[model samples]
Target: MIRVEEAIAIVEANSTKMPVKQISVSKALGYVLAEKVISPINMPPFRQSAMDGYAFKHSIRHQYDIVGVSQAGDHSNIKLKTTEAIRIFTGAFVPDNADTVVMQEHVMANKESILIAAMPEKNTNVRPKGEQIAKGEVVFEANTLITPAAIGFLASLGIMTIAVYKKPKSAILVTGNELVKPGQKLKKGKIFESNSVMLQAGLQTFGLEKTKVYRVKDNLKATKKALESILNKFDIVLISGGISVGDYDFVKEALLQNDVKELFYKINQKPGKPMFFGSKNETLVFALPGNPASSLTNFYIYVAPAIKNKMGFAEIHKPKLVRKLNADIQNTTGKTLFLKAKYDETNVTVLDGQSSAMLNTFAVANSLLIVPQEIEEYKKDELVTLLPID
Candidate 1:
């Protein structure tokens, strides 16, 4: 078995980002831009009023004549003299001679004229043309992540579509003879299958929602057939169970029979020592242990990064930090240990029920405490490294 760091490096070194494609900006949230976008026109497009008030050329006078009204979406051609003002609402186009606006609350209005309460500064309450952004300027650089605000900004700029990295197509294969569907009746010596749904949910968290799932019994022919069918059709293939060295464990041999190049067989880590990673052409394959907790942990540590890297993300790993341990813990397995725990900003506490087959502790865990092989014991208040789940 290889070390955990070595396994992670291997997976990252083999990943390649997907090709770019053009998509509508309305549906491009959470996608990374593949090219820089330039503004086609100046934001606001014209001199705009910043408030509902009277607009006129600023002068030393305290009273002025009100000529006409300018609503938000209409063009106003009203001419203003030196001591003349026009009623203008917010976002309305300002007349050519209007240089300043006094808010309606600060002025007294009458039938055909308004009296200013106080003399205002020149060019106040007016949004100059191109104030937000100028035309022909770079609005967003390459590798920018699309957010809700970004969508609105682009839509306001009349941008209908943008170029982005296409998300990878993925597939999952579940292999076990003693597994049954969740709603079905439990026969003798049978357990409900939970890894497929768990892994699917994990993938969906990273914007990989469209995935195909397949199931096969512990048979070599069936496993090989399943592998052969999807080996070249998808960018990632995740297989759960049948990777260990047992009589019914036929995943390794089936992968070999299908001409898949094995990158690594196992890792020197707890709860996931029998993990397998391989590749056939461009398809990356990960065969995880059948245990629900182990499968989910390996998915988060290994598979999540691979998916993110393929989608052209810069930061693929979970956020890491060092904090003091709230309670004592020990590791004597001579391998890296990943324990589910809860952490405040100051300290981390390892939760109970750290069994490989159980996910009770993981359900409440906000982070995974990493205990290296060189450390045997950690007392309370000792510093520890953790990967906080996002």
Candidate 2:
């Protein structure tokens, strides 16, 4: 057994970045860049027009002769004299001789001549070449997250692919003969298996999409066999059930037999005190309590951070906040308590149904109120720590 902080530290020390792989930028959303990305060409490769307007060399005169027209994508070599202008559209290349552009709305056009209703400043409405980004400039440094806007920026720089830290391959193992898959008729003393589905969704929320699920009977032989196969094939393995010191709890023994070194077997925390963390070679394993709420709580507090670390994220934990308590609460269990609750920017309210088996409150709760072991009670409006659930 270990304290919650010590268990969290152990997990963090063991988690490492995965190998890098080159993937298309278009498909690299939510991935951390393993290499610095450089721009191959200047954004707005040429001096572009910023508006549908007339391009002209700046002069003191209010009127000018319209020499020619230039639309976007036109490779025009037309030159302009001082006091001469050309009809131009948005994004159109401004002739080298032209230094300014006046929006169409600001100019009065009559036949081949235009009068600037308002004399514009020099370089107005003209996007200078390389204004956004210069060629050979570092677009993003290593460990940068590829957001949707990042994809567009990279695409604009003509970057087709980027090197990113590879996402971990993970699997979920559900243990217990008393569990039955959903849609099946419930036999005597059998319950529908939901931990696997809930865990799968939880993993997806952390960006681990390609997860495999396995079912095992609550026996040493079956549990060991499942562990052997999964530990060798996955970077992460999540087992729900069979971890406590029960007659049929074979997961802990099976893991040890399979040479999985236990980092910590339990944590001094509420709802998930029986949680287990171990590693077999390079594969990380988490044995969560079978109770639905406990499994999910452990997944968020521990597994999600491991996933983020493997993918090279700097900030792994969910956002932590401190707010005044909206209601009084007590915890006399002599253990740190994690209570699902509702929170706004300034305050938090611990909801009912803090039982390890119930997830109804968790479904509606947006945060977890952390009650320290030393604090037996907290008065309403007292400051407290909260972790907003994602």
Candidate 3:
């Protein structure tokens, strides 16, 4: 068995960056930028009012006379001279001659002229052109994820399209002859297939949507044929079962027979020691344990980050937080254990069960408490690393 870090390093070395493509801003969310996005025009495009007030010069301290009324999207044709003010609403362009703005509430207005109660400050209430974004400036850098706020920022720069990396295609294959389809009546010793559904939903969190699920009986011929058939279609293939040393486990043998390059066969981790990884024709193949929690945990820790990096994201790992353990934890040596835990601002508590097959306790889990291989027991109030669920 190999260490977890060694296995991760092997996977990262074989990972390839995806090519870039131009996509419309409407459909660019969650994709990583391939090129630097620069602003073509100044944000606001011209000097505008930041608030609903009156536009005038600072020299006109006490006197105020209405010259014109300017609303949003209106061009100011009338210029303000000494002691002259224009009624301006929010987002209206400020005239060239105007240098200050006095709020309407501070000024007492009559039929034609107004009374200034206070002196207006220079450049007050004015959103100057290029104040938010300057023309020809790099608004976003390459490999940055396009979020909702990022889209708005690009729109403000008049960018309708952007270059982003294409989403990678992934597939899930479940192996077991005793497994029956959902909605079907359960027979004696027959279990419903739930791994594929759980994995599909979990994979979606990492922006993977176009995933296909295939079921194969417990046999070498069937597993080999299924693996070879789906190998050419997807960039990554996830196998849920048939990787252990049982009599029916044939996924590893089938992959070897197909000339797939083996990265690592097993890792020194609990409930997932049989996890395997390989590649063929630049397509990745992951042999995960049959247990639901084990498969999901492995996917989040290793596969998800690999997919994100392949899609050109600059940061592939999720955010980690350091928290004090509320209880003492024990773990087997020589393998890093990622146990489900409940964490909040005050403290973090480990879940009741650490079994790979269990999924009930993981539902309410907000973080994963990591225990390194070198440590045996963590006393109460021990600071530990926690990986937040994204």
lDDT per model, in order? 0.91, 0.91, 0.86
Query: What TM-score does each of the candidates earn?
Result: 0.93, 0.96, 0.96
Candidate 1 lDDT by residue in tens digits, 1-390: 899999999999988888999999999998988899999999979999999999999888889998889999989778889978899999999998889999999999997899999767999999999998999999998877789999999999999999999888899999999999999999999999999999989888868788899999999999999999988789999999999999999999999999999999999998788999999988899999999888988998899999888887768887788999998888889989999989987988999988999898899899889998788999999999998885
Clashes of 2: 0
Better lDDT candidate (2, 3): 2
Tens-place lDDT per residue, model 2, 1-390, is 677888888999899899999999999998999989889999889999999989998889999999898999996958888868999999988899898999999988987899999988999999999999999999999888889999999998889999999989999999988999999999999999999999999888767888999999999998999888899999999999999999999999999999999899989999899988999877999999999999988988899899999888868987789999988898889898999989887888889999999989999998888988788999999999987885
Q: Give the TM-score of candidate 1.
A: 0.93
**Residue pairs of candidate 1 with colliding backbone atoms:** none
Model 3 over residues 57-79: C-alpha lDDT tens digits?
Answer: 78736777887999988885686
Worst 10 residues of 3 by lDDT: 56-65
Residue 249, model 2, lDDT: 95
